[model samples]
Target chain A: MKEILLNSENYQPGLSIDCVIFGFHDNQLKVLLIKTSYDNKWSLPGGFVPIKEDIDTAAVTVLNDRTGMQGIFLRQFATFGSIKRKDPNFDSTVLDYFEIPKDAGQWFTQRFVTIGYYALVDFLKAIPQKEDNHEIIEWIDHKEVPELILDHKEILDKALHTLRIELNLMPIGYNLLPEKFTIPELQKLYETILDKKLDRRNFLRKITHIGILKKLDEKKSNVAHKAPNLYTFDKDKYEEVLKNGLNQGW
Target chain B: MKEILLNSENYQPGLSIDCVIFGFHDNQLKVLLIKTSYDNKWSLPGGFVPIKEDIDTAAVTVLNDRTGMQGIFLRQFATFGSIKRKDPNFDSTVLDYFEIPKDAGQWFTQRFVTIGYYALVDFLKAIPQKEDNHEIIEWIDHKEVPELILDHKEILDKALHTLRIELNLMPIGYNLLPEKFTIPELQKLYETILDKKLDRRNFLRKITHIGILKKLDEKKSNVAHKAPNLYTFDKDKYEEVLKNGLNQGW
Candidate 1:
């Protein structure tokens, strides 16, 4: 396997794609990470770009394989290409663990200019399917992510930074909310991300006026019998409302 | 040179950096392009990434070598990696132009996943430098850009798109404006980018309120003696004000 990977004909040399699969669970932003069996070290789900394939296509393929197709909202954010981006300690550990490599480790040891991609997904939908070499797969809160292999930690931090900027600048709101959620749940999601309290009646009054929230027909909620138990954003309607601008006072 | 390039020991194989050097002049956005002596074909100011150098460092070096050090605001926006992004016609032309033996041309013919960087610079600042293999070098209006080699046209379009979005979403007002300019020149620059005429009185009234613009004490304006002839943005102060937010009606 090491010999096959060392061959340059199969993949583009010194280029890779790492996916920062973000999910919102327990009101916290989470990142999907995998533990490789070789070194039992955490790493972002990533792979080399096949010689004949596009970089983005490689990202999608790698993401699907890692998460059983969880990364639906994909964006190529930035590239990490620093000479010292790789971790020498991680490399030595992996190389020492798998002793079939000396000269064969050149491909694995070279400096890789990795394209960083972020994927926004609902946590429930990510059914992680472990690869043959993966010892563990888990979604850890962004704030609590362990020390990752290579420059994965730097890549993860950058993805979160871009996400924060996007949330502040654009009309993309609460995209990580569950498939069907109550208004209170939606409000909680907003409050969690913003890290501030909101007036209950005022929040309800202001949000209802925009009419982007569609009341889903479901069982009554424990808190409010008058309000539907579940509601979802009418994505098209929400976007249409946003075109004219919505001053939600964020 | 051809033999050396084909050998992967010198450079990161299949990875390149293409720079979109944007300048606003004559009320139109411009991009710097170089016509290669190899094919006499127009291309973005670009070069291959050396094995040891960072991708962004490579971009700065390439930009400086091409434009005598004018790309001051450098940002890596996207990566172009379509399998068919390369121009086979260009490859044949260059290979035939150089009369390189078929085997040695592999380096030129292979697919390169290029990192796209956009540089916001004052147009007059970019003094075009002809590289050893460049037949011609010019900064052409983006709208009037000639057919560029490879997928550079797509890359250029993305850069312009990002620029427009940035201008609209943030307090990045008239960054393309000259270092020092009068109210009228600033208004003209904004109008050109916005693609619409703004009311003269309303423009001045609204712009002056933020106090981000500082009047230079050099001279009085040609239009009105009461107004300063040249004004420049207090970038630091402007950013400080934006921290609280500025609502410039688009």
Candidate 2:
């Protein structure tokens, strides 16, 4: 591959974008992670921002390229810029993995200020694909996420924090759930993202009181016990609540 | 003066920091702006982020250098990175203002991705200062702020939006008020920030119900009407509310 730093005409040398793609499945919140060619270490889907593209657009492109999903709920939450952000030995590892000369790897190792964009995608609909031959993409339970390369662990933590705060203000969790989901399923999604068990009765009372959910007559099927009523988010009501602000205490 | 882009040893070329220093005084919310040497247009107090410094620290340094305030409540809200962010004629303006050759002005006019930080400072306590001979510092009423250079107007608006959302979740308004303030004074501050007329009874009732304020026995001294009781933010209570999450809908 051509050295990006040497060819600065196309890419901004010191800037990059990392995406934390969150999805909910099996009553667990999960994040998409890729095992890199270098030492098989896991990393968030990331890439350099092209000089000509808007940063926001670049983030969306990166998300689409990595997750095989488009037009999702993607938002830039934070930027990480620490001198020690890249692992000290990362360059040498990349040099060995790419089989590139040391000089060529210099550009890849240079300090970068990465803008983080978190995305919430429907896991069942998303078709995760490997971006290149050297990497493997997989979904891992957020609670069971392994130690990530560089400062990715920090980035993931911040994404989860932003997601939790956003959950209280907006009906974004609906993006991770099916169109018609039971209250218990929705509550489980919240508990997973928040990493805490919430009182089910309180959660139901509080969420219903917000008046954003439309209770459907249908119920969950093929369940061992009594199936719970399914509900879908009322987009109009959600937007109205967002405009008026939802002060629901989580 | 040496061109920053040519002398990349000290600073990163494409990255910069812009500060939205919000202050409250005269029962009005205001932002600190700088009159630039080029076209005398106002801009947010901003400077380049040095290659050696973390982006977060650069924001704090820029805030202190511009406003003469340290250890204040400053937070990074967003980063603006549009290819069309710099005005079309900004390069020529810089060339004329700095008396630099066109070649040298290229570095000054390069596309910059500015990370925006908004600071909440007590208007009476902050001593705004000019950074250099080419700039003049002034505080303009938030509502009366004139058209600014590049996407600064958008940045300022985003900062205000973020601040409003944050006001509901955190006790950030205390940063703009004095240690001991009356209820009316505090209510006026909220009204100014939210840019709306809140019901007097409702506003007071809601704020007090949050239980983060200590209702002191003291009252306003210099007032013609009944002296409203003085109160100070109870930091401990605020922290508890923040930890438990403030779901109080405004």
Which candidate has the top score in lDDT?
A: 2
Predicted candidate 1: interface RMSD? Answer: 3.5
What would the TM-scores of all predictions be?
0.85, 0.92
Weakest ten-residue segment in model 2 chain A by summed lDDT: A1-10
lDDT of each residue in A1-250, candidate 1, tens digit only: 3344544687887888899988788878778888877754698988888888888889999878877764377889999999886557645556655554566567777788899999877778778767654368888877788888777888988887676555434444445777678777777766665556778887788678667787877844575547657877888877686454543334
How well is each residue in B21-136 modelled by candidate 1, as lDDT tens digits? 87788877678888867654588988878777888898999888877764377789999899886657755566665555666667766788889998877777678887654368
Q: Which ten residues in a row have the lowest lDDT in candidate 2 chain B?
A: B1-10
Clashing pairs in 2: none
Tens digits of per-residue lDDT for model 2 on B42-99? 8898877777789989889988887777888888899999998666776576666656
Cα lDDT over the full model 1: 0.74
On DockQ, the leading prediction is: 2
Residue by residue across A1-250, what tens digits does model 2's lDDT show? 3354433566766888999999999988899999976665788988877888899999999888877887888889999999776567664766666665676666666678999999999999998888668778999999899878889999999998888887767776667998998888888888888788999899988888888899898988999898888899998988788776776556
Q: Which stretches in model 1 have alpha-carbon errors above 4 Å?
A: A1-6, A90-104, A173-175, A194-211, A217-220, A224-230, A238-250, B1-6, B37-41, B90-104, B169-175, B196-211, B217-220, B224-229, B238-250
Query: How much lDDT does each candidate structure score?
Result: 0.74, 0.83
